[model samples]
Target: MSSDFEPILMRNVGVAKAADLQVYEARGGYQGIRKALQMSPEELIDEVKKANLRGRGGAGFPAGMKWSFLPKERKVTYLCVNADESEPPTFNNRVLMESDPHQLLEGIMIAGYATRATVAYIYMRGEFTEPFHILQRALNQAYAAGYFGKKILGSDFSMECYIHRGAGAYVCGEETGLIESLEGKRGWPRIKPPFPAVAGLFAKPTVVNNVETLCCLPHIVLRGAAWFTAIGPQGSFGPKLFCVSGPVNRPGCFEESMNITVKDLIYGSKFAQGMIGNKAVKGVFPGGLSMGVLTGDELEMRMDFDSPRKFGLLGLGTAALVVFNEDTDIRDVLLNVTRFYAMESCGQCTQCREGTGWMYKIAQRISLGAGRREDLDILVETTRNMGMMPGLSICGLPDGAAFPIRTLVEKFRAEFEQHIVRQEPGKVERVLRVLN
Candidate 1:
């Protein structure tokens, strides 16, 4: 929570007429692209590498390293900016695009230039009606200002950018699924080995980056990489925006050093400002539902990508924290997340297609006070059989579907058992040790 403030991304968020083109130029908005165009594409790549900026979408992969994966030959390169923002409790992208549309345009220009992508698209979610319109208006302004289209800024580095709206499907949040949807196909994820960097979007070399990931390029290009790296701890460079929502006193999006602990995020005055109504904090999904829950002693863990593993958890996924109060039912929580994944599964992989439905049925029954004696076994066994582990599915959706159910039943086993005990009386005690 402690650091020097620059507010590069949110600089124009609250100002009147902030989305106007002249206002953006007045606030030094597109200067990063101008500076980026002055440097060679290789230099742009190297400068970002030195900055150590990671993807903000979820994976946290090195941005420069991802760009380096593209082949050197200029054979119809493309860049796709992921503005889908489909995950629950993830509204950071929506805020950025709606408030400072030009900042994103500038970032797209720099990222497209660095990757040598002659054509780029912002794959925005269909639900983002306002953000999409704001972006389109900004794009028109940029084109009219000679910042986009044929000969951008009168330089040889030319690229055209467009916005592709997606029907509201969670699978499209995945990169390959987004590409497939962009091609006017169903939103099913494609297999890898030929990643987007080598062959993506019409079988040409491409790069897919998130809205926040592209927004950082301007700062990295304008300021030095050393300045960006100095903002956070080792392996956790740059300022990160944490979307802290749920049962908290002041739930909102907060930008802070990546080193901020989960405890601070929920309790810090500058962040969530402690739990609402002095209610006791029961559990928290530290990084959206995709990452596992933290409870009891695990609340003290730091919010960095690596620190969550100290408790046998996946790394920070989107850094979107959804908290729960002591009064909330654990069974209902399990069923809520289970149903979400089930409905959004894309139903391509056998594991996720079947596993999510099984877990949802069990959780739904348990939440409604009809839990069976052997339901615990069915839940855990179903998750394991679904191969919910990473790299098992076409995309990471199954893993997201698996983590909460696995972690909740593991960490909060007693609570889950209590549901069955209330429904089946002594039957739950019979298989309790096997579950433990």
Candidate 2:
């Protein structure tokens, strides 16, 4: 539990005392926001652009690029911080919010100033009750210090933020879905012809960013973009918080430079304990279940935005690493993830609504000892087709749910085949429990 006084989001959490307004100020916190107030909005955006910080939520879209998309005219822009960390096995955002509330608050204020957003919203997940209160307290502190509300820091610029709790739908994590929830509507994603930058909440220009993504803004402004860019691997800039779980002995979150390899992270002491039961490492879901699977041999590949791209996988989604060992069953893993998508699908898009359910049923049948050998091919083909379907889908919900299935089937075909051949009753129950 002992570690150095690293300023990474999770660095001082659980070991040293939590950072409060006084402690944060003593440690050079809020310096970014203070520095940001001195720069023009365009200058702040330019600084972020130079940092090359892509969104940390699932998609790796550039943060400054998204900000630049906002209309240049003086309209009421909005900055919505997506704190709904609902992606399965992803808990990095939660750590950031709970441990370093001031950092997030500072980031939001800076972002609001840059975007000229009159109002900001932190869309917290329903389960994040504790973090919600923590953030609420931080917001109160920020306002008390004149960091929020009218004429922030005695400048003409002004920004106000409110916390909106989601109703526990995974779809709400999608940017548009989060918007809909903020608008007091059902948490369903809206079409994107008029992207959020153009027409968003209350039909105003909005910039939706992840908690971790926004949290990095203050650091980028305080340290300069070059320093942030130079820390991580090429293209993948700044320190990344990887939430490693599953059978690892130390199943917790770690914030490290992107230079760390997947092997180093898996074996790093930051995790809960290493791998459980001395089980041989089988494979890893590098960026949660949404990104495609990586076998043990691929462990040497550095965990970065581009490294996984070479293998037809993405590194930015959720920033969660779920490791599986030899004793873990691939079928059970597929079933578990499929059911999650099936339950979370908003049913707005016919393809995602029906396809996710179909995939779940097939996975359930196979895991229940009722599947045939040919069912494997059906699962693979269904996932492939689902990935091609078109709709008003604002996010990759369909693809997120299908990518793992397709990868698992392709990489662990023999294991899936074994499930059908054995038809063990005990195995069926175990797989179902894991899926649930």
Candidate 3:
């Protein structure tokens, strides 16, 4: 099925002759920012709220709600754009940062204006060095053009943005971690009572938004909320950029309507090229490792925030759609993902620090052919308990790290059982070395 999908964030990427300012302005770029400058800050926030745009950085929290959390009376609120796309199999944000830095800049400007923020910062992963340069150049251009700095677009609204690069910790993708890193401190999550909005970034009221979340702001401002809402599903409004990777014939990002079924996305003419190696798809990690795996049966489900929730999985996690063919080992995949969370955990939260490591061990054992059937139950129980741990720990790192273990045990029980039944003598030792 040939797709009629037009790329939004990545529309002129690589194809445009010039990636500089002149080319972007000619193609209707910065119009959103120009329009946003005309509206009152409150009106802009209302528009975004009416659009029903949700955060695209794993958690599906409403973008408007997050912005609304800002204390209106505060004079120095900050909008931190999270560009640290550390989630495995998630590359959608990179597309925006690399291809169309202006889109995100425009979004940041709008978000800053809405929240009465005079300064915005783009906290980017260090690995995105190239994109970082691209964005920095874009910000300079915007400043020169009067889109940034005092009296932006001659509207008395001043916003200045700077790019801060992270040292490549997955935890830094978390809002609090990003804040801590931005403050030049150890990237650890702070305990939340004073959520970022109440007290954040030097203890001032602030709003942290993901890159994609901020990128949607300009569109919301330009088209109006109703128009944006009319494009996608009822609850999930606007177009979504779905990144497909791992063993697909055509592995890349594609923008599509939210309600598109997983089957149509993976097998459609515009994506995947009909599965890897012509093998039957055994499972899919629809929203990266944190969201857990959905088997072939669930792949037919719609690709929306609530669709996977109905199957007991979270679907809005980076919108990463990783396809695993029959040749893939579920145990191995789970083990790798578990190990990642374990290594990345900041050790501030006991449940996350300990539970992630423990889960990784069990998953590694199973992948090495030494898993006992009871171990599967233990993995599930431990993860369930850990996920229930108390304290509103800064960031969802604890819960995010634990969900995969719980979901994997529940969704792929047979795979774990097979590992145990086919245990080979001394295979555990070999697997341990490999895992290490």
Cα lDDT tens digits for candidate 1, 48-100 = 99998999998889999999999887679899999999888788898889998
RMSD of each: 3.4, 3.7, 2.3
Most accurate candidate by lDDT: 1
The true-versus-predicted C-alpha distance at residue 317 of model 1, in Å, is: 0.8
Whole-structure CA lDDT of model 2 = 0.82
Q: Which segments of candidate 1 are over 4 A away from where they belong?
A: 1-6, 387-391, 424-436
Q: What ranking of all candidate models by lDDT puts the best one first?
A: 1, 2, 3
Ordered by TM-score, highest first, the candidates read: 1, 3, 2
Error of 2 at 302 (Å): 1.8
User: Which candidate model has the greater lDDT, 1 or 2?
Assistant: 1
Per-model TM-score versus the true fold: 0.95, 0.93, 0.94
Better of 2 and 3 by TM-score: 3
Cα lDDT tens digits, model 3, 224-253, are 999889877788888788988877788888
